[model samples]
Target chain A: MSRPSDVYLFGTCLVDLFMPDAGMDAITLLETLGIRVHFPQAQSCCGQPAYTSGHPREARDVARSQLDLFPGDWPIVVPSGSCGGMLKHHWPTLFAGEPEQERVVAIAARVVEFSDFLLNHLDWQPVDTGPATRVAVHTSCSARREMNVHTTSWALVDRLANVTRVVHDHESECCGFGGTFSIKHPDIAGAMVTDKARALEDSGAIEFVTADAGCLMNINGKLALDKATPLRGKHLASFLLERTGGKS
Target chain B: MNSQPVTLYPSRQFKDNARAALADTELRGSLRSAMDFLMAKRSSAFPDTDELDALRTLGEAIRQRCLSRLPELLEQLEERLTANGVTVHWAETPAQANAIIHGLVAARNGTLMVKGKSMVSEEIELNHHLEAHGIQALESDMGEYIVQMAGEKPTHIIMPAIHKTKAQIARLFHEKLPDTPYTEDVDALIRIGRNALREAYLQADVGLSGVNFAVAETGTLCLVENEGNGRMCTTVPDLHIAITGIEKVVEKLEDVVPLYSLLTRSAIGQPITTYFNMISGPRRPGEKDGPREVHLVLLDNGRSQAYADQQLRKTLQCIRCGACMNHCPVYSRIGGHAYGTTYPGPIGEIISPHLLGLENTRDLPTASSLCGACGEVCPVRIPIPEMLMRLREESQRPAGEAVDHPLRGQGAAASTTEALAWRAWRRVYASPGTYRLFGWSATRLRALTPPTQAGWTQNHVPMTPAPKTLHELVREREARRKES
Candidate 1:
């Protein structure tokens, strides 16, 4: 199939509320590539928190609202792998035998994570006009298992000529954001996040980049609290936009 | 049915046990190193990824075939065993299994028994029963012996005393053994355990062992172990008793080959164990030396319950390999003792519910981060994360709600406040207008948001909402662009 000229953008709840710059940068990144980005104002959360927490009834209700928002044949690009996974893999399971199953099947087929869209769908490369910077990419658990974006992000980052990828240990494990899990089980969550932060710091990278807003928020929140820390967390859109000279 | 209830570890206090385990730095260090070593070994075991995937597929199919004809295969096994002069006994519960073994020992006038590593026996609490009845039951496996001497249960399935360091074992042997010099050298400790267990093997009146696979077509019991103690326990004494769960039976002898290979490789990275013993029957008339009489006990401790359900039957296909535990982040961090159950880690969280009940193991399924590590390493391809989610759903259902699943309404997620909140959330997210209204109010009241959000604020800075929603900002940006 030929690539579409325009696509609908699903700015997940985390990006919509806590990190609006990521949402804006994602659009700018797409628009700079000659593709029109459409934002559906009626779209809300992807209901991953409820679905993963074992509340399927609430999850179905929330999933149905967004399932109808982007009704066109345009690819639905999401900035977060976690929300993208929910849309692509989990939405059909939530509406298995219902009348909305067809809509879910159609919508799920078009859902693509941000990095995956850049590498696979658009087949576009970034123009490297920025300074050299060494960064480590944090691939969220959902990205590795639910979507194949974990490997695609490496390819996406490799497009920048001056950007170098730093190696780290335990790079594929969860950042412990897990939506409501961090709040419910604080001690366990703290232990996990602590391990993640130490591993990223040990890599000697100046910035930690990830495609998911939840992980960016969680890791950046922790890194921001420490005054002397050398590392900064950046979303894939912002990092790509900045490195490609698309950030105006 | 037996009258007295068997005493098993209580998983109801899992939270408390995990807290205690996390507090101990020494244990955390041991578990971390052990898990890392095991994971690395397993990764290197299968050099060709395609070959490994093929083996896993074959292994899963073998198990599925076995379970599909479980009842018929079990009866065939009993008939074959009876024809081969090996008596087969069925146990419906732990108490019943204990009673049957006790009766056999009493009939033989046995006073002492040496045991190989058997997780089924642990589930039945056989050693405690024998002790209560004034009979001596000793563990012959090195790790099991250490835990038995310390008056503690085996924390891990494969490595019973993985929680202990060499120094701790040296101290344990020094305190427990008479006239024994304290030595922490690995070889020295093995010599100490071997010498002690050798003496027990001769003096004991009965030899007991656990079966890794019970073949039905032929009445053969297969065992795989690195230590020679399993062979000695089954061959040293005149009377030998082999106990295993009924689900361990497979349809044919050939089916065990791939499963056994996967078991050892996934377990500890061994291409094959040091000893692979296959016992079919007792000593024949012309046989030189073997057990005079052999007994096979089939323990059904809630395995049948797991079998009755379609989705849950996958739990029984486990070959008792510790790969899941070796890869689990939670198990690696807290160690097995924190789970407070006979079995621990990812497998324990899923199967313990069927063995015990959901009420006792409600907190276990929630302990995982659901990172899918266990599922990725599982030899039989059991979806550990999916099962965990199913169990979590079962645990949260109301006490008596009607659901098609077998474990409905058996969980602790039935809190009224949480239900009401989810209902309210459904209302807000289901409607775009309602969601926008809440989003506007949340952005406006960002300063009024609480600084401490329950347990999260204890460590993390409070996560306050942003000043404006992305849609609101996008609208303003579009209007300015139009004017320009």
Candidate 2:
């Protein structure tokens, strides 16, 4: 497939509120590649929280609101794989039997995760301008299974010549920030994140990068609380922009 | 027959149970090592991804085809078994199944029944019922034997004693059995268990086992196990009884090829188990050393209810490989006992609601992080995560909502507050204006964000919004671009 001249950025809710810099960096990286990025102001949450929580009606209502925003044929690039999966894979199921089913399916077909859009569509190969640094990559379950872009995320990171991608133990396991699951079963979620944090820290990386904001927040929050280690996490978009010398 | 109720961890106390299980360092270490080993074994067993995918697709198609004609296949199975001189019994409930088995034993004046590993028997609390009626149901499978000897429920479907370390098993044997010395040596432990169970096989008036697959076309009941205990249990006694869920039936014996291959490989990474017993019927005329009577008890136990819905019928496709639990992150963390059901982990979360009702197993569905590992690793391609989400929907549906097929105890976990919160979330997110305003205010008042956020803040710091929303950042960039 040829690279599109224009694309729409679906900055997920977590990126919009908790990590605005990541969203901005995503636009910067896209723009640096000579592609015109369109940010639709009407976009909001992907309704994944309610969708996975079994509230389909509410999830549909919220998800339906964004269907009209991306009216163009340009690919919709989502920085977070979790939200990207909700749009690409689950929207059809959410709108099944409804009049908007075709519309949702068409929109879902154009949905592309950030790493996948960069690695596959554009074939991005960035020149490393930053200092030598080692970083670990954390792939969300949605990215790994739902969107099937975990390898693309890793390959995108591996493109940086100066960055040494360290592999963590249980790299495929969940970081346990399962939206409401963290709030519902905190102890289990805590145990999962604790193990994930320890693994990342033990990987000898100064920082970890993930393509999903939920995991970034969960891992960083746990690391912030633990004064024992100074290891923190960064969103892949920002990390990529930083390594590629794009102004953040 | 009145029997002592089977000991249960009670799904209602899932939170407490998970907390308790997580606190046990020994159990955590054992589960961690076991899961790692099993995962590695399974991965290496199927080194070719393309071949694995093709096999899984075939396995799924076979199960779906069999389930599409479940009623007809079940009837055909009964007819073929009957023609082959085997008694086939249908049970709609656990109590009815127990009564049928108890009556059979009582008719034979059986004082002891040597049993192979059977989770269905555990589901019906058959041992307790038999013991209540002056019958001893001795578990002959090594794992099941260890669990029964300790008077504890099997923690895992495939490996009942997986939770117990060898040292723990040695201590259990030394304390529970007569004149048994404590020995942590694995070989010695197996010898001791085998010796103790050897006499029970001969003394048992009846033998019982579980069927992995019931072939309707061939009238053969297939049993897969690593140990020879299942074969011994079926052949040693004068009478043998096999119990299984109604969903275990396959239309043709050939259909079992892909399923059996996938089951062992996905389960413990074994290409084939040590013993694969195919019992068609009782000893034929002049046949040597086979049981005189063979009976199969097909128990519904809420399976028909699951079969009623097209989407839910997929839950019946499970081959009981226990691969889902082994691959599940939540199961690895909390272990199987924390689930408090006959089947646990991803499969249990979906199936338990049907068996025990959503009200009794409300928390089971929501126990996972929606990690998708179980669904990915499933041999027969059971969409376990999707089924879990569906169960969660059933558990929280409105009290009086109408549907084509309502699950038992629907809306058991529904909460007015949770519903209202989602409603509020929809209202804010569904509108561009409200969402923008909410984001703006949230960021502006980020300092007022509370330090403690119920469960989230229990371990980590509070989540504070950024000073500027993406909407604002994008707007500023657009303005600057136009000005430049």
Best by lDDT: 2
DockQ for each candidate? 0.63, 0.87
Candidate 2 — which pairs collide?
A: none
Best by DockQ: 2
Number of the predicted model whose TM-score against the real structure is largest: 2
Worst 10 residues of 2 chain B by lDDT: B1-10
Every candidate's CA RMSD: 2.8, 1.6
Model 1 residue A226 lDDT score:
59
Report clash pairs, candidate 1: B395-B411, B395-B412, B396-B413
Q: What is the per-residue lDDT of model 2 for residues A112-187, given as tens digits with 9 covering 90 to 100?
A: 9999999999999899898999999999999999999889878987899998999999999999998999999999
Task: Give the alpha carbon lDDT tens digit for every residue of B95-131 in model 1.
Answer: 9999989998898889899999999998888998998
